[model samples]
Target: MVGVPTAIAILAFEPPHGATALLALLLLAAAAAGFREPTPLWYIERGWAVLLAGGFAVSTALAPTRPILDRSLLTVAIAGATVAAMGAVRPELLVGLDWQVADQFERTLARYDFGWLGGPPAEAAVRQFAALWQALYPAMLVLASVSALAVTVYLLGRVRGEESALPPLGRFRFSEHLVWVLAAGLVLVALPVGAWADRAGGNIVTVMGGLYVLRGTAVLVWLGASVISSGWIIAAWTLAALVLYPVTMGATLVVGVSDTWLDLRSRLGVAGNKE
Candidate 1:
């Protein structure tokens, strides 16, 4: 709904080359969703959300062309309501996992002028905006990383619980089969690099590592919940990580060491030799 108009507007404004990348990213996201171990109802909910978000975003982007406004409004309504519903279902996840880290990033950005490295801003307002964004980028990354780490820890804890009541890993098990597919995808994606920075570059490894960690954590949480009544605590930790990762990562960069070491150590101590 929203995305169709948005995509059309974007195509109208941007060159065809941009569409390719956008489409690829969307496809990747779709593939990732396919791998999730969700019930039919869950899938329907997720699908609708994705569609609404995509549609709204695309339509908004292309709004200048004077396309149908009612449909766009409907898309926005659906997407917004869905997000609200999600929050209602998992308020902790919404607040703990998302908002805390977002605040940290915003604060960090305020500390530094946005890092605009490119050409001169066309206007004073634009320049200020760019500067603001530049300053905020590092903080945002740190926040995102912290959030991710927290989620990972929470999931890991759940996986280790003995009496956990968490759901099964199901399609999101991150099994050998999935690993192989991911590996193959990586190799295929990386094959185009030249000698200066070959296919097996640090960037490739970094991306793959991140993916592995994310998927592994999700699976661990699922498994942990299966064996313990208190497995949901893992999800809480994940939320914490997501919120704190950005600030923590930024601190690590500034301090020249991993900021999460103490936290990780403490968590390990608590978990003990349960593995």
Candidate 2:
């Protein structure tokens, strides 16, 4: 349900199991039309999409408009709706996942930080970092939500076999345009435009750093197949990665940054985008 994301806010962090169960029934109906009833995927998607959108709106409309949830919820609702539509033809993709994701984001806004872990001796620095973390939490939520969706899409697809709602996984590649993201974040951190700008910049680094790591992993996978297909070698690399984490991460970051020009994957003739 597209609007079911707002229902997440209305339900206060835990998605209603009732709506989820109902959604499952509707999804089954849609799937049936596709596999058995000679139904157009678009027709089923259009019908249920409208129904889901209404439910989502009703839930959001009912949420208590306190402090920031009023505004942030709307923005997230829009984002969740967009994500939902991206897989409209797949019933499982409409699995009210955005609700769970919204709940996690809600909790992050409420209380997510390294406070329990503690850091630095300077009181002022600690408070400043806390404030910064709060500002960046939204961006974190976006990345986390997207990641969860990807994982869910994959896992659920596995369960459904050929009937998997989402499409198959393709080759991985980070965008060259994201290279500017790294530069912008560095500049923002180096020179504070404003508190908001600084927060955004730092969060950009966080998100983009994650992408870089993914790119690095992609490189490793490609190399595993091309350089040496030995399972033992791959296992050794994994062990090394676990043991030398910071070094591995730093190396990945470097590779990711250099990829803008290197296009290492392309050079290896692996997953080079024709586009």
TM-score, each model? 0.25, 0.53
In terms of TM-score, how similar is model 1 to the real structure? 0.25
lDDT of predicted model 2? 0.55
- Model number with the top lDDT: 2
For model 2, which pairs clash?
3-56, 4-56
Which lDDT tens digits does candidate 1 get at residues 221-267? 44455545664776676577579987534433332112123223223
Error of 1 at 96 (Å): 41
lDDT for position 199 in model 2 = 73
Could you say which candidate leads in TM-score? 2
lDDT at residue 148 of model 2 (Cα atoms): 44
Q: What is the lDDT of residue 78 in candidate 2?
A: 63
Off by over 4 Å in 2: 1-135, 155-160, 163-170, 273-275
